[model samples]
Target: MAAANSVWISLLVSIIIVILFIQAVPTAHSQNDEDQLIWAKRVVSGNQVITNLQFYFHDVVGGRNPSAIRIAEAPQTKNSTTFFGSLMMIDDALTVGPDPASKPVGRARGMYGSAGQTDFGLIMALSYVFSDGIYDGSSFSMLSINPATETVREMAVVGGTGLFRMARGYAIARTYWLNAATGDAIVGYNVTILTYV
Candidate 1:
Protein backbone atom coordinates (compact mmCIF):
# COMPACT_ATOMS: atom_id res chain seq x y z
CA MET A 1 0.00 0.00 0.00
CA ALA A 2 2.82 2.43 0.91
CA ALA A 3 4.76 1.39 -2.18
CA ALA A 4 1.71 2.06 -4.44
CA ASN A 5 1.28 5.57 -2.96
CA SER A 6 4.96 6.39 -3.60
CA VAL A 7 4.73 5.28 -7.29
CA TRP A 8 1.60 7.42 -7.80
CA ILE A 9 3.36 10.46 -6.31
CA SER A 10 6.41 10.00 -8.60
CA LEU A 11 4.17 9.75 -11.71
CA LEU A 12 2.26 12.87 -10.68
CA VAL A 13 5.51 14.84 -10.27
CA SER A 14 6.76 13.80 -13.74
CA ILE A 15 3.48 14.81 -15.34
CA ILE A 16 3.59 18.20 -13.64
CA ILE A 17 7.16 18.83 -14.79
CA VAL A 18 6.25 17.89 -18.39
CA ILE A 19 3.30 20.27 -18.34
CA LEU A 20 5.50 23.14 -17.11
CA PHE A 21 8.12 22.57 -19.84
CA ILE A 22 5.51 22.55 -22.56
CA GLN A 23 4.09 25.88 -21.38
CA ALA A 24 7.55 27.49 -21.24
CA VAL A 25 8.47 26.66 -24.84
CA PRO A 26 7.53 29.45 -27.23
CA THR A 27 6.19 28.95 -30.75
CA ALA A 28 8.20 30.15 -33.78
CA HIS A 29 5.60 32.69 -34.80
CA SER A 30 5.47 34.20 -31.34
CA GLN A 31 9.26 34.69 -31.26
CA ASN A 32 9.28 36.26 -34.73
CA ASP A 33 6.46 38.62 -33.82
CA GLU A 34 8.34 39.76 -30.75
CA ASP A 35 11.43 40.58 -32.81
CA GLN A 36 9.44 42.56 -35.32
CA LEU A 37 7.88 44.60 -32.53
CA ILE A 38 11.34 45.40 -31.16
CA TRP A 39 12.80 46.70 -34.46
CA ALA A 40 9.84 49.00 -35.10
CA LYS A 41 10.87 51.33 -32.29
CA ARG A 42 13.14 53.44 -34.54
CA VAL A 43 12.78 54.54 -38.17
CA VAL A 44 13.62 57.73 -40.07
CA SER A 45 13.12 58.68 -43.70
CA GLY A 46 13.87 61.48 -46.19
CA ASN A 47 14.35 62.30 -49.84
CA GLN A 48 17.83 62.31 -51.41
CA VAL A 49 18.43 64.34 -54.53
CA ILE A 50 20.92 63.32 -57.20
CA THR A 51 21.18 64.75 -60.66
CA ASN A 52 23.31 64.85 -63.82
CA LEU A 53 24.63 61.35 -63.29
CA GLN A 54 26.99 60.96 -66.18
CA PHE A 55 29.46 58.32 -67.30
CA TYR A 56 31.41 57.17 -70.36
CA PHE A 57 31.92 53.44 -71.04
CA HIS A 58 34.50 52.04 -73.40
CA ASP A 59 35.84 48.61 -74.40
CA VAL A 60 39.28 48.41 -75.99
CA VAL A 61 39.43 44.82 -77.23
CA GLY A 62 36.43 45.34 -79.49
CA GLY A 63 37.81 48.09 -81.73
CA ARG A 64 41.62 47.98 -81.39
CA ASN A 65 41.88 44.25 -82.18
CA PRO A 66 40.47 43.38 -85.58
CA SER A 67 40.14 39.72 -84.58
CA ALA A 68 38.45 40.45 -81.23
CA ILE A 69 35.53 38.45 -79.85
CA ARG A 70 33.34 41.52 -80.31
CA ILE A 71 34.03 45.25 -80.06
CA ALA A 72 30.90 45.67 -77.94
CA GLU A 73 27.61 43.92 -77.19
CA ALA A 74 24.46 45.96 -76.96
CA PRO A 75 22.25 48.09 -79.23
CA GLN A 76 25.73 48.79 -80.73
CA THR A 77 28.34 48.06 -78.07
CA LYS A 78 31.95 47.14 -78.85
CA ASN A 79 33.08 45.54 -75.59
CA SER A 80 30.97 43.05 -73.69
CA THR A 81 32.66 43.85 -70.40
CA THR A 82 34.04 47.14 -69.10
CA PHE A 83 34.86 48.90 -65.83
CA PHE A 84 33.46 52.45 -65.51
CA GLY A 85 33.00 55.24 -62.97
CA SER A 86 31.20 58.61 -62.87
CA LEU A 87 30.59 61.65 -60.70
CA MET A 88 26.93 62.61 -60.26
CA MET A 89 26.66 66.38 -60.16
CA ILE A 90 24.13 67.61 -57.61
CA ASP A 91 21.83 69.94 -59.45
CA ASP A 92 18.05 69.89 -59.40
CA ALA A 93 17.24 70.83 -62.98
CA LEU A 94 16.39 68.25 -65.62
CA THR A 95 18.70 70.05 -68.05
CA VAL A 96 21.83 68.75 -69.73
CA GLY A 97 24.61 70.87 -68.24
CA PRO A 98 24.88 71.12 -64.46
CA ASP A 99 25.94 74.39 -62.87
CA PRO A 100 29.70 74.76 -62.71
CA ALA A 101 29.49 75.76 -59.04
CA SER A 102 27.27 72.77 -58.23
CA LYS A 103 29.03 70.13 -56.20
CA PRO A 104 29.31 66.48 -57.10
CA VAL A 105 26.95 64.88 -54.63
CA GLY A 106 27.46 61.19 -55.31
CA ARG A 107 29.53 58.63 -57.15
CA ALA A 108 28.47 55.86 -59.54
CA ARG A 109 31.09 53.27 -60.26
CA GLY A 110 31.14 49.54 -61.04
CA MET A 111 32.00 46.90 -63.58
CA TYR A 112 29.79 45.48 -66.30
CA GLY A 113 29.52 41.73 -66.58
CA SER A 114 28.92 39.80 -69.79
CA ALA A 115 25.67 40.23 -71.67
CA GLY A 116 24.83 36.58 -71.00
CA GLN A 117 24.24 37.47 -67.38
CA THR A 118 20.50 38.15 -67.69
CA ASP A 119 20.13 38.98 -64.00
CA PHE A 120 20.04 42.75 -64.58
CA GLY A 121 18.88 44.86 -67.48
CA LEU A 122 22.16 46.71 -67.87
CA ILE A 123 23.96 43.67 -66.47
CA MET A 124 25.97 45.91 -64.14
CA ALA A 125 26.14 46.47 -60.40
CA LEU A 126 27.03 49.98 -59.22
CA SER A 127 27.66 51.69 -55.89
CA TYR A 128 26.51 55.23 -55.10
CA VAL A 129 28.37 57.25 -52.51
CA PHE A 130 27.43 60.62 -51.02
CA SER A 131 30.75 62.44 -50.74
CA ASP A 132 30.04 66.06 -49.83
CA GLY A 133 27.60 68.14 -47.81
CA ILE A 134 25.52 66.52 -45.08
CA TYR A 135 25.60 62.94 -46.33
CA ASP A 136 29.30 62.30 -46.69
CA GLY A 137 30.40 58.66 -46.76
CA SER A 138 26.84 57.35 -46.92
CA SER A 139 26.78 54.86 -49.73
CA PHE A 140 24.07 52.69 -51.24
CA SER A 141 23.93 49.90 -53.78
CA MET A 142 22.64 50.30 -57.31
CA LEU A 143 21.18 47.11 -58.61
CA SER A 144 20.79 47.26 -62.43
CA ILE A 145 19.52 49.36 -65.31
CA ASN A 146 18.63 48.09 -68.79
CA PRO A 147 20.31 50.30 -71.34
CA ALA A 148 17.99 49.15 -74.10
CA THR A 149 15.03 50.98 -72.62
CA GLU A 150 15.09 54.77 -72.13
CA THR A 151 11.92 55.13 -70.08
CA VAL A 152 11.90 55.90 -66.37
CA ARG A 153 14.45 53.40 -65.02
CA GLU A 154 14.69 52.07 -61.48
CA MET A 155 17.40 50.88 -59.06
CA ALA A 156 17.42 49.33 -55.61
CA VAL A 157 19.07 50.98 -52.59
CA VAL A 158 20.02 48.03 -50.44
CA GLY A 159 22.01 49.56 -47.54
CA GLY A 160 24.02 52.62 -46.50
CA THR A 161 26.58 54.11 -44.09
CA GLY A 162 27.28 57.18 -41.88
CA LEU A 163 24.16 59.28 -41.29
CA PHE A 164 22.27 56.79 -43.43
CA ARG A 165 23.39 53.80 -41.40
CA MET A 166 21.10 50.80 -41.72
CA ALA A 167 19.40 52.57 -44.61
CA ARG A 168 17.28 50.90 -47.24
CA GLY A 169 15.38 52.45 -50.09
CA TYR A 170 14.73 52.69 -53.84
CA ALA A 171 15.82 55.13 -56.52
CA ILE A 172 14.07 56.40 -59.63
CA ALA A 173 16.56 56.64 -62.50
CA ARG A 174 15.27 58.69 -65.40
CA THR A 175 17.25 58.52 -68.58
CA TYR A 176 17.53 62.11 -69.68
CA TRP A 177 19.58 61.00 -72.63
CA LEU A 178 21.17 57.74 -73.82
CA ASN A 179 23.49 57.16 -76.72
CA ALA A 180 23.12 53.53 -77.66
CA ALA A 181 25.88 53.97 -80.21
CA THR A 182 28.65 55.09 -77.81
CA GLY A 183 27.23 53.89 -74.46
CA ASP A 184 27.24 57.41 -73.04
CA ALA A 185 24.31 59.01 -71.25
CA ILE A 186 22.95 61.54 -68.77
CA VAL A 187 20.66 60.26 -66.03
CA GLY A 188 18.77 61.72 -63.08
CA TYR A 189 17.92 60.10 -59.79
CA ASN A 190 15.37 60.73 -57.08
CA VAL A 191 15.91 58.48 -54.09
CA THR A 192 13.84 57.90 -50.98
CA ILE A 193 15.85 56.62 -48.04
CA LEU A 194 14.85 55.01 -44.75
CA THR A 195 17.35 54.86 -41.90
CA TYR A 196 17.96 55.12 -38.17
CA VAL A 197 18.84 58.80 -38.54
Candidate 2:
Protein backbone atom coordinates (compact mmCIF):
# COMPACT_ATOMS: atom_id res chain seq x y z
CA MET A 1 0.00 0.00 0.00
CA ALA A 2 2.94 2.41 0.88
CA ALA A 3 4.78 1.69 -2.38
CA ALA A 4 1.57 2.27 -4.41
CA ASN A 5 1.03 5.63 -2.67
CA SER A 6 4.65 6.72 -3.37
CA VAL A 7 4.30 5.83 -7.08
CA TRP A 8 1.02 7.80 -7.29
CA ILE A 9 2.64 10.85 -5.65
CA SER A 10 5.67 10.73 -8.01
CA LEU A 11 3.38 10.42 -11.05
CA LEU A 12 1.32 13.40 -9.90
CA VAL A 13 4.48 15.54 -9.43
CA SER A 14 5.71 14.60 -12.88
CA ILE A 15 2.39 15.63 -14.44
CA ILE A 16 2.53 19.00 -12.66
CA ILE A 17 6.09 19.63 -13.88
CA VAL A 18 5.10 18.80 -17.46
CA ILE A 19 2.14 21.15 -17.25
CA LEU A 20 4.35 23.99 -15.94
CA PHE A 21 6.92 23.44 -18.71
CA ILE A 22 4.22 23.55 -21.37
CA GLN A 23 2.88 26.85 -20.01
CA ALA A 24 6.39 28.33 -19.86
CA VAL A 25 7.12 27.48 -23.52
CA PRO A 26 6.10 30.02 -26.11
CA THR A 27 3.57 29.18 -28.81
CA ALA A 28 3.14 30.70 -32.28
CA HIS A 29 0.53 33.16 -31.02
CA SER A 30 2.21 33.96 -27.72
CA GLN A 31 1.97 37.67 -26.90
CA ASN A 32 5.44 37.89 -25.26
CA ASP A 33 7.22 36.14 -28.12
CA GLU A 34 10.23 38.25 -29.05
CA ASP A 35 11.17 35.89 -31.85
CA GLN A 36 8.70 34.56 -34.34
CA LEU A 37 8.92 32.09 -37.20
CA ILE A 38 6.13 33.48 -39.40
CA TRP A 39 4.46 36.78 -40.09
CA ALA A 40 2.05 38.13 -42.75
CA LYS A 41 0.78 41.60 -43.45
CA ARG A 42 -0.64 43.63 -46.29
CA VAL A 43 1.50 46.18 -48.11
CA VAL A 44 0.57 48.93 -50.57
CA SER A 45 1.08 47.88 -54.18
CA GLY A 46 1.46 49.66 -57.57
CA ASN A 47 4.41 51.83 -56.60
CA GLN A 48 6.62 50.54 -59.41
CA VAL A 49 8.87 52.80 -61.50
CA ILE A 50 10.04 52.03 -65.02
CA THR A 51 13.56 52.91 -66.06
CA ASN A 52 15.07 52.67 -69.55
CA LEU A 53 18.82 52.45 -70.11
CA GLN A 54 21.03 52.33 -73.20
CA PHE A 55 24.68 51.33 -73.36
CA TYR A 56 27.35 49.73 -75.51
CA PHE A 57 29.07 46.47 -74.53
CA HIS A 58 32.68 46.20 -75.72
CA ASP A 59 33.83 42.58 -75.88
CA VAL A 60 37.61 42.67 -76.41
CA VAL A 61 38.77 39.12 -77.05
CA GLY A 62 41.91 39.69 -79.16
CA GLY A 63 43.97 42.30 -77.33
CA ARG A 64 46.84 41.37 -74.97
CA ASN A 65 44.61 42.28 -72.02
CA PRO A 66 41.36 40.83 -73.35
CA SER A 67 38.17 41.48 -71.37
CA ALA A 68 36.73 38.09 -72.27
CA ILE A 69 38.59 34.79 -72.07
CA ARG A 70 37.69 31.16 -72.73
CA ILE A 71 37.84 29.29 -69.43
CA ALA A 72 36.61 25.80 -70.30
CA GLU A 73 35.39 23.73 -73.21
CA ALA A 74 34.68 20.19 -74.38
CA PRO A 75 37.20 18.29 -76.51
CA GLN A 76 35.19 18.96 -79.68
CA THR A 77 34.47 22.63 -78.79
CA LYS A 78 37.07 24.00 -81.24
CA ASN A 79 35.79 21.91 -84.14
CA SER A 80 32.10 22.17 -83.25
CA THR A 81 30.23 24.34 -85.77
CA THR A 82 28.43 26.18 -82.96
CA PHE A 83 31.32 25.93 -80.50
CA PHE A 84 29.04 23.92 -78.26
CA GLY A 85 30.12 23.25 -74.64
CA SER A 86 32.61 26.16 -74.71
CA LEU A 87 32.48 28.44 -71.67
CA MET A 88 33.98 31.91 -71.37
CA MET A 89 34.34 34.38 -68.52
CA ILE A 90 33.80 38.01 -69.45
CA ASP A 91 34.42 41.33 -67.75
CA ASP A 92 33.53 43.48 -70.73
CA ALA A 93 33.12 47.23 -70.66
CA LEU A 94 29.87 49.13 -70.76
CA THR A 95 30.34 52.41 -72.55
CA VAL A 96 28.28 55.39 -73.60
CA GLY A 97 29.23 54.88 -77.24
CA PRO A 98 30.18 51.97 -79.49
CA ASP A 99 33.77 53.19 -79.77
CA PRO A 100 36.23 51.53 -77.41
CA ALA A 101 37.50 54.97 -76.33
CA SER A 102 34.02 56.13 -75.33
CA LYS A 103 33.15 57.24 -71.80
CA PRO A 104 33.14 54.32 -69.40
CA VAL A 105 29.85 53.67 -67.63
CA GLY A 106 30.11 50.20 -66.10
CA ARG A 107 31.17 46.59 -66.60
CA ALA A 108 29.39 43.46 -67.81
CA ARG A 109 30.86 40.70 -65.65
CA GLY A 110 29.73 37.12 -66.03
CA MET A 111 30.06 33.80 -67.77
CA TYR A 112 28.54 32.64 -71.03
CA GLY A 113 28.55 29.14 -72.47
CA SER A 114 27.71 27.85 -75.91
CA ALA A 115 24.94 25.38 -74.99
CA GLY A 116 23.35 24.69 -78.33
CA GLN A 117 24.72 21.78 -80.31
CA THR A 118 23.32 22.75 -83.73
CA ASP A 119 22.59 26.46 -83.27
CA PHE A 120 24.86 29.29 -82.19
CA GLY A 121 23.15 29.83 -78.85
CA LEU A 122 24.89 31.17 -75.79
CA ILE A 123 23.57 30.83 -72.24
CA MET A 124 24.56 34.08 -70.56
CA ALA A 125 24.52 34.83 -66.84
CA LEU A 126 25.74 38.40 -66.56
CA SER A 127 25.56 41.27 -64.13
CA TYR A 128 25.61 44.84 -65.42
CA VAL A 129 27.41 46.71 -62.67
CA PHE A 130 26.78 50.40 -63.13
CA SER A 131 28.83 53.28 -61.73
CA ASP A 132 27.61 56.28 -63.72
CA GLY A 133 24.94 58.92 -63.14
CA ILE A 134 21.82 57.89 -61.25
CA TYR A 135 22.55 54.19 -61.42
CA ASP A 136 25.78 54.50 -59.46
CA GLY A 137 26.41 51.50 -57.21
CA SER A 138 23.52 49.67 -58.80
CA SER A 139 23.59 46.39 -60.71
CA PHE A 140 21.19 44.35 -62.77
CA SER A 141 21.36 40.60 -63.41
CA MET A 142 20.49 38.70 -66.59
CA LEU A 143 20.13 34.99 -67.31
CA SER A 144 19.00 34.02 -70.76
CA ILE A 145 19.76 32.00 -73.84
CA ASN A 146 20.89 34.31 -76.64
CA PRO A 147 20.53 33.14 -80.23
CA ALA A 148 23.81 34.56 -81.49
CA THR A 149 22.84 34.74 -85.16
CA GLU A 150 19.66 36.72 -84.56
CA THR A 151 19.61 40.30 -85.78
CA VAL A 152 18.11 41.34 -82.45
CA ARG A 153 18.13 39.37 -79.21
CA GLU A 154 15.93 39.81 -76.14
CA MET A 155 17.17 39.00 -72.63
CA ALA A 156 15.44 39.11 -69.29
CA VAL A 157 16.54 41.58 -66.61
CA VAL A 158 15.62 39.34 -63.72
CA GLY A 159 16.62 41.38 -60.70
CA GLY A 160 18.79 44.18 -59.37
CA THR A 161 20.25 45.90 -56.35
CA GLY A 162 20.56 49.47 -54.99
CA LEU A 163 18.44 51.90 -57.04
CA PHE A 164 17.01 49.04 -59.06
CA ARG A 165 15.67 47.06 -56.12
CA MET A 166 13.16 44.35 -57.04
CA ALA A 167 13.77 45.07 -60.70
CA ARG A 168 12.21 43.05 -63.49
CA GLY A 169 12.18 43.74 -67.23
CA TYR A 170 13.77 42.96 -70.58
CA ALA A 171 16.80 44.02 -72.57
CA ILE A 172 17.28 44.17 -76.31
CA ALA A 173 20.72 43.61 -77.79
CA ARG A 174 21.93 44.45 -81.29
CA THR A 175 25.31 44.00 -82.88
CA TYR A 176 26.85 47.43 -83.33
CA TRP A 177 30.27 46.37 -84.69
CA LEU A 178 32.31 43.20 -85.17
CA ASN A 179 35.79 42.18 -86.22
CA ALA A 180 35.86 38.91 -88.12
CA ALA A 181 39.57 38.31 -87.61
CA THR A 182 39.81 39.07 -83.90
CA GLY A 183 36.30 37.95 -82.84
CA ASP A 184 35.83 41.26 -81.06
CA ALA A 185 32.49 43.03 -81.02
CA ILE A 186 30.56 46.01 -79.76
CA VAL A 187 26.98 45.21 -78.85
CA GLY A 188 24.30 47.77 -78.03
CA TYR A 189 21.86 47.16 -75.19
CA ASN A 190 18.50 48.81 -74.57
CA VAL A 191 17.18 47.76 -71.18
CA THR A 192 13.79 48.54 -69.67
CA ILE A 193 13.45 47.85 -65.97
CA LEU A 194 10.47 48.10 -63.63
CA THR A 195 11.49 48.55 -60.03
CA TYR A 196 9.98 49.44 -56.70
CA VAL A 197 10.18 53.14 -56.02
Candidate 3:
Protein backbone atom coordinates (compact mmCIF):
# COMPACT_ATOMS: atom_id res chain seq x y z
CA MET A 1 0.00 0.00 0.00
CA ALA A 2 2.91 2.36 0.76
CA ALA A 3 4.49 1.72 -2.68
CA ALA A 4 1.16 2.17 -4.40
CA ASN A 5 0.59 5.48 -2.63
CA SER A 6 4.04 6.69 -3.60
CA VAL A 7 3.37 5.74 -7.22
CA TRP A 8 0.12 7.64 -7.20
CA ILE A 9 1.84 10.71 -5.68
CA SER A 10 4.53 10.67 -8.39
CA LEU A 11 1.88 10.52 -11.16
CA LEU A 12 0.02 13.45 -9.64
CA VAL A 13 3.23 15.52 -9.49
CA SER A 14 4.01 14.71 -13.12
CA ILE A 15 0.54 15.80 -14.25
CA ILE A 16 0.87 19.09 -12.37
CA ILE A 17 4.28 19.72 -13.97
CA VAL A 18 2.83 19.14 -17.44
CA ILE A 19 -0.01 21.61 -16.83
CA LEU A 20 2.41 24.25 -15.53
CA PHE A 21 4.72 23.79 -18.50
CA ILE A 22 1.89 24.25 -20.98
CA GLN A 23 0.81 27.50 -19.35
CA ALA A 24 4.36 28.85 -19.16
CA VAL A 25 5.06 28.29 -22.84
CA PRO A 26 3.99 31.13 -25.06
CA THR A 27 1.01 30.39 -27.33
CA ALA A 28 0.03 32.20 -30.53
CA HIS A 29 -3.50 32.68 -29.29
CA SER A 30 -2.57 33.52 -25.71
CA GLN A 31 -4.13 36.67 -24.26
CA ASN A 32 -1.33 37.22 -21.70
CA ASP A 33 1.21 38.69 -24.11
CA GLU A 34 2.51 42.12 -23.23
CA ASP A 35 2.56 43.03 -26.91
CA GLN A 36 0.66 41.57 -29.82
CA LEU A 37 2.06 40.64 -33.20
CA ILE A 38 0.97 43.22 -35.76
CA TRP A 39 2.27 45.10 -38.73
CA ALA A 40 3.44 48.68 -38.21
CA LYS A 41 2.51 51.57 -40.48
CA ARG A 42 5.11 52.51 -43.06
CA VAL A 43 6.98 55.81 -42.87
CA VAL A 44 5.65 56.98 -46.24
CA SER A 45 2.12 56.09 -45.29
CA GLY A 46 1.27 59.68 -44.33
CA ASN A 47 2.34 63.27 -44.87
CA GLN A 48 1.05 66.57 -43.53
CA VAL A 49 -0.11 69.64 -45.39
CA ILE A 50 2.20 72.52 -44.70
CA THR A 51 -0.13 75.19 -43.36
CA ASN A 52 0.00 78.95 -43.86
CA LEU A 53 1.89 78.61 -47.10
CA GLN A 54 1.60 82.02 -48.64
CA PHE A 55 1.83 83.14 -52.27
CA TYR A 56 1.39 86.30 -54.32
CA PHE A 57 -0.11 86.22 -57.81
CA HIS A 58 0.28 89.15 -60.20
CA ASP A 59 -2.05 89.03 -63.19
CA VAL A 60 0.08 90.45 -65.96
CA VAL A 61 0.55 89.81 -69.65
CA GLY A 62 2.90 86.91 -70.40
CA GLY A 63 2.82 85.91 -66.75
CA ARG A 64 2.21 82.24 -67.57
CA ASN A 65 4.03 79.88 -69.86
CA PRO A 66 1.20 79.88 -72.41
CA SER A 67 1.38 83.65 -72.02
CA ALA A 68 -1.90 85.50 -71.67
CA ILE A 69 -0.92 88.54 -73.72
CA ARG A 70 -3.90 90.31 -72.21
CA ILE A 71 -7.02 89.57 -70.25
CA ALA A 72 -9.08 89.69 -73.46
CA GLU A 73 -6.75 87.06 -74.83
CA ALA A 74 -8.47 84.75 -72.35
CA PRO A 75 -10.85 82.37 -74.02
CA GLN A 76 -14.49 83.45 -74.10
CA THR A 77 -16.90 80.58 -74.32
CA LYS A 78 -20.58 80.09 -73.54
CA ASN A 79 -19.88 77.65 -70.75
CA SER A 80 -16.30 78.70 -69.92
CA THR A 81 -13.70 81.46 -70.27
CA THR A 82 -9.90 81.55 -69.90
CA PHE A 83 -7.95 83.92 -67.72
CA PHE A 84 -4.34 84.95 -68.17
CA GLY A 85 -1.65 82.56 -67.12
CA SER A 86 -0.08 83.77 -63.86
CA LEU A 87 3.24 83.33 -62.05
CA MET A 88 3.51 83.66 -58.33
CA MET A 89 6.01 83.29 -55.53
CA ILE A 90 5.33 81.54 -52.28
CA ASP A 91 6.01 83.82 -49.36
CA ASP A 92 5.45 84.09 -45.60
CA ALA A 93 2.95 86.95 -45.49
CA LEU A 94 0.20 88.61 -47.46
CA THR A 95 2.27 89.77 -50.37
CA VAL A 96 0.79 91.74 -53.28
CA GLY A 97 3.39 92.03 -56.05
CA PRO A 98 5.63 89.71 -58.08
CA ASP A 99 8.71 91.13 -56.35
CA PRO A 100 8.31 89.98 -52.78
CA ALA A 101 9.79 92.55 -50.37
CA SER A 102 10.48 89.78 -47.84
CA LYS A 103 9.70 86.23 -46.70
CA PRO A 104 10.18 84.53 -50.05
CA VAL A 105 10.60 80.77 -49.65
CA GLY A 106 9.78 79.24 -53.04
CA ARG A 107 8.78 80.05 -56.61
CA ALA A 108 5.73 78.83 -58.55
CA ARG A 109 5.76 78.53 -62.33
CA GLY A 110 3.04 77.14 -64.59
CA MET A 111 -0.16 77.85 -66.47
CA TYR A 112 -3.08 79.45 -64.65
CA GLY A 113 -5.52 80.33 -67.41
CA SER A 114 -9.10 79.97 -66.29
CA ALA A 115 -11.86 78.14 -68.13
CA GLY A 116 -15.57 77.20 -67.85
CA GLN A 117 -18.86 79.08 -68.05
CA THR A 118 -18.95 80.83 -64.72
CA ASP A 119 -20.28 84.40 -64.54
CA PHE A 120 -17.79 85.11 -61.78
CA GLY A 121 -14.70 86.00 -63.82
CA LEU A 122 -12.55 85.39 -60.79
CA ILE A 123 -14.15 81.98 -60.54
CA MET A 124 -12.26 79.55 -62.77
CA ALA A 125 -10.02 76.50 -62.72
CA LEU A 126 -6.26 77.09 -62.50
CA SER A 127 -3.23 74.82 -62.81
CA TYR A 128 0.19 75.79 -61.52
CA VAL A 129 3.47 73.93 -61.15
CA PHE A 130 5.16 74.25 -57.79
CA SER A 131 8.94 74.49 -57.86
CA ASP A 132 9.96 75.21 -54.30
CA GLY A 133 10.14 73.64 -50.84
CA ILE A 134 8.39 70.26 -50.71
CA TYR A 135 6.34 71.02 -53.84
CA ASP A 136 9.16 70.50 -56.25
CA GLY A 137 7.99 68.93 -59.53
CA SER A 138 4.41 68.80 -58.27
CA SER A 139 1.69 70.91 -59.86
CA PHE A 140 -1.69 71.56 -58.29
CA SER A 141 -4.83 72.90 -59.90
CA MET A 142 -7.38 75.18 -58.43
CA LEU A 143 -10.06 73.24 -60.30
CA SER A 144 -12.55 75.99 -59.70
CA ILE A 145 -13.32 78.68 -57.18
CA ASN A 146 -16.84 79.88 -56.65
CA PRO A 147 -16.76 83.57 -55.81
CA ALA A 148 -19.61 82.80 -53.48
CA THR A 149 -17.29 80.38 -51.73
CA GLU A 150 -13.94 81.98 -52.48
CA THR A 151 -13.17 82.12 -48.80
CA VAL A 152 -11.99 78.53 -49.13
CA ARG A 153 -10.73 77.04 -52.40
CA GLU A 154 -9.74 73.47 -53.11
CA MET A 155 -6.87 72.87 -55.50
CA ALA A 156 -6.75 69.50 -57.19
CA VAL A 157 -3.35 67.84 -57.22
CA VAL A 158 -2.87 66.57 -60.75
CA GLY A 159 -0.20 64.02 -61.56
CA GLY A 160 3.40 65.28 -61.41
CA THR A 161 6.59 64.39 -63.23
CA GLY A 162 9.99 63.31 -61.93
CA LEU A 163 10.13 63.46 -58.12
CA PHE A 164 6.46 64.31 -57.98
CA ARG A 165 5.22 61.65 -60.35
CA MET A 166 1.77 60.17 -59.70
CA ALA A 167 0.92 62.81 -57.11
CA ARG A 168 -2.63 62.78 -55.83
CA GLY A 169 -4.20 65.14 -53.28
CA TYR A 170 -5.71 68.58 -52.92
CA ALA A 171 -4.70 71.92 -51.49
CA ILE A 172 -6.87 74.09 -49.33
CA ALA A 173 -6.35 77.76 -50.08
CA ARG A 174 -7.78 80.92 -48.57
CA THR A 175 -7.51 84.22 -50.31
CA TYR A 176 -5.65 86.64 -48.10
CA TRP A 177 -5.97 89.56 -50.50
CA LEU A 178 -7.48 90.34 -53.88
CA ASN A 179 -6.78 93.42 -55.96
CA ALA A 180 -9.60 94.32 -58.29
CA ALA A 181 -7.37 96.68 -60.26
CA THR A 182 -4.80 94.08 -61.41
CA GLY A 183 -6.59 90.86 -60.57
CA ASP A 184 -3.70 90.03 -58.27
CA ALA A 185 -4.19 87.86 -55.22
CA ILE A 186 -2.46 86.74 -52.08
CA VAL A 187 -3.37 83.19 -51.17
CA GLY A 188 -2.56 80.89 -48.32
CA TYR A 189 -2.59 77.10 -48.45
CA ASN A 190 -2.47 73.94 -46.35
CA VAL A 191 -1.58 70.58 -47.83
CA THR A 192 -1.36 66.98 -46.54
CA ILE A 193 0.09 64.23 -48.68
CA LEU A 194 1.90 60.88 -48.98
CA THR A 195 4.44 59.71 -51.57
CA TYR A 196 6.34 56.51 -52.23
CA VAL A 197 9.74 58.21 -52.57
CA displacement after TM-score superposition, residue 28 of candidate 1 (Å): 50
Best by lDDT: 2
Worst 10 residues of 3 by lDDT: 37-46
- lDDT of each residue in 1-197, candidate 3, tens digit only: 99999878876865565455434432222223323311011123123222122344433332343223333333333234333232222222222222435333334443333332443424334545555546455554444443422577666555445544555556666665565665555555444333445
Once fitted onto the true fold, the runs of candidate 2 whose alpha carbons sit more than 4 angstroms away are: 1-46
What global local distance difference test value does model 1 have? 0.43
Which residue ranges in model 1 land beyond 4 Å of their true spot? Answer: 1-102, 114-120, 145-148
TM-score, every prediction: 0.47, 0.75, 0.45
Worst 10 residues of 1 by lDDT: 37-46
Better of 2 and 3 by lDDT: 2
| Weakest ten-residue segment in model 2 by summed lDDT | 36-45
Q: Could you tell which candidate, 1 or 3, scores higher by TM-score?
A: 1
lDDT of 1 at 129: 62
Candidate 1 vs candidate 2: the TM-score winner is 2
What would the per-residue lDDT of candidate 1 be over residues 5-101, giving only the tens digit for each residue?
Answer: 9878876865565455434433223322432221111122123222212211122222343111222335433332332222122212122123212
Among residues 3 or more apart in sequence or in different chains, the pairs in candidate 3 whose N, CA or C atoms overlap within 3 Å are 49-191, 49-192, 79-116, 79-117, 80-116, 80-117, 83-114
